[model samples]
Target: MTIRIGWIGCGRHATWMLMPQLARSGFEIVAVCDRDEAAAHAAARQFGATEVYGDYAEMIASARIDAVGMAVGPEVHYRATLAAIARGLPVFMEKPPGATAAQAEELMRASEAAKVPVTVGFMKRYSTGNRMAKRILDGDAFGPVLGIHGSYMTAPTYFAGEVDYTGFYLHHCVHYMDLIPWFAGAEFADVQLRKSVPGPGRMLLHMNFACENGVIGNVIMGTVQSRGTPMEFVQVMGDQNRVEVENVINLAWHRNPPFKAEDPQATLDPGCDTLVWTPNFTAAANEDHKGYHALLLDVAAALEGRASPAPVIRDGWLAMRRLERMIALIEG
Candidate 1:
């Protein structure tokens, strides 16, 4: 019983990331679409999709797919997602959510109005290591969180061009931006940003903020990151314990630390333990990263009523508001 999927935006992301996962997941690719006809045809051919479309509305109105995966950029995310929602099917949309708070809110309202499930593409939340870390942090062992420190850096070249695209932080950092408070189960309450413009399309930001739940946060971002650098980590310090997820897929959780005290009597209480998790890619499949395949699988479950849609539309709106707040603090 393969779920039939209709995919919009057959560009780099769909071609390079989403399509392969959809194909490998055993979901029927009913239709592939893009503004570029050739790209749509190419995706259909590569992914064994039976239909192709140059227009998103036509694809939605015409295809018989059970779900839609939209990888369009932030600029048109609102419109594309609206179309998918109106079609009354579950949807998976790429992140940064909508460009504005109004757009994000509208998406949430529309999803609610139509009773269709929609999840944003904050795929980091679905990563194996992040999941493990979240489970531990959610347990009683980690207790109440004290502070969360997260850092994400990527080349602005990722966005390069496109009208009204807010540089790197607003455009690409939403994944971690969404994950910060998410790990702590809180909402962003305040933010302070000190930004330095390095050059065109490049910025460095140092931010400190707090969640409504009284969890403090610090984040550092750079748009000129090296091509291969994986400078991303989220460190959460709790009641005498700590967990950090690195590069989205590696995590280290530390519990109990032996104090190098001048008094050796503390040795009796010594219990220093560190546990690490890394993806064993030895026989890894598309589901290894928990991004592509995992998301699609989750979407299928959500549409089938087996489980609730995760990182739902409400999450997207919240993340967008956070990104917008950061942009305001910086641009002002």
Candidate 2:
């Protein structure tokens, strides 16, 4: 089923990274809205949306759309998502669903009360290597996950203008808030954080957490790296086995392999060996390494009333709750 969607952002992220993939995922851009009239009109022209508006509410009120999608600010995401829910429309929004955990909780209640699905853009879960690692973890060979470690970094661009870490926490750090718990298949039970600020706009943190399912993990996040290089890594440990994803594209799964260097007949064993995979960038195929396309496919499925694994508002609320806890730890 084609979901007629009114998209509420025309920024570079929406136009370049997101909207172009909507058609492939069975979503038709029926309307586009942005505060910038030119950007809205440009997105409409580029994505074949017939209607355009500078006001999100005006577009939601007038557009003949079946759903709503947006990549705007946290405050706007909260307000626009609420507006769309009031109209009984399903929604898709970029992460940090609201500026605060309380707002996210309110949105969660609103979604449940309205009986509408709200998908949040926690795309890291759908990255190719991470997805493969998840499949391996769920398989019979890999036992229950015991722990996870993650390192995600970015430059100080989020704090370029000022020393505010708000944007850094919301946009950069929030992805791991959703991802690590997801990998552990539990909610966080306790958290302890240590922070370091080397200079203005450059901060680092090490967050250690225990999950409700008895899984423990540590994540390192900061605005201290160069964006031109790879900025993410994850490792999930199981019993005598582990899986690692490097930069979201390369994967390695190490099973309980015996050392065979002494044997002349030694050979690679399928039963216990290190399995590795990397994408073929040279292939003449369209692929989204960042996972946006896969994420939207799930969103489209949910909008069609089909079963999907799309991250919902509940996930957003949980991530926000965890984020707030981490922030409190830093402040207190």
Candidate 3:
């Protein structure tokens, strides 16, 4: 059976990424809805959606959609998702499920009560590099995990618009915040955040977290980085090995004795290398190109009743709790 999907918030994100992949993924784009009628109509025209609505409620009430993809902003996510769940629709929501912890929890309870599956767009967890990282961690190839360090830096063009620095932690960092626990196979016990000095069009955040496995996580995020900087990089260190995912595309792993000597003449082996690694770019053509296909695969499994979605309702709640702590620290 084909999955009839309806999309709410047909903005640039939907147009540029999700919409283009829907057809090929065995999903039928049955309806499009947006607050802006022109945007909705344009999306409908481009995707051959059978219907368009300026109001999501009207679209949800009329369409025979099996699943709904919500691309609305953070402020509207709670209401939109609650509405969809009340109508018994499975939902795929954009990241940072809500603007506050209470809202995310409420949605979790509602989805549970309604027996609807809800997936947060924490797509990084579905990436090939992340999968391999998980495998290595689980297999103890990394030995007993020590700690993790990650950085997410993007140029101003990616900021979309002006942003309040404190809010950026909740809006953006939640993605990595959510994944840290997953990657470590642990839970976050506490979190503290520090912000950069007051500035215009620039922001930086430092996050310190205590994990369940007795490991510490230090995450650095900045919106004031050089334009040429890579988008995202993650380094996970363990007792015996370490893995680095750079720019969300390339992954490199090192086992034992982390650094290699620079000069060949100075090294005992002469032609020896310090880091033994391999690069894989198997899925570089797809939208976002990192774990886009894996996300679709998980969605398909969930739709087929073969498996449950990752970063499900519970994951969203957990992530929100972490965000709440960060917000409290920022507010204080």
**For residues 1-99, what per-residue lDDT tens digits would candidate 3 score against the true structure?**
678999999999778777777676668899999999999999999999988988888887789888888788877777888888888888888777887
Alpha-carbon lDDT, every model: 0.79, 0.93, 0.76
Which segments of model 1 are wrong by more than 4 Å? 24-26, 158-167, 259-272, 283-287
lDDT by residue (199-243, candidate 2, tens digit) is: 998888999999999999999999888999789999999999999
List TM-score per model, in order: 0.90, 0.98, 0.87
List model 1 lDDT by residue over 1-332, tens digit each. Answer: 68788888988877888778765655788898898888988988888888888888888888988888788876667887788788787787877667777798998999999988887777777787777888988887789988999888877675555523364655566776788888878887888989877677777788898888999989898787875888688899997799998887988888886555676665443246677778778765534575667766676666655675467888888887788788788778
| Predicted structure 3: clash tally | 1
Ranking by lDDT: 2, 1, 3
Model 3: how far residue 31 lies from native, Å: 0.4
Error of 1 at 38 (Å): 1.9
lDDT (Cα, 0-100) at 217 in candidate 2 = 90
* Candidate with the larger lDDT of 1 and 3: 1
Worst 10 residues of 1 by lDDT: 158-167
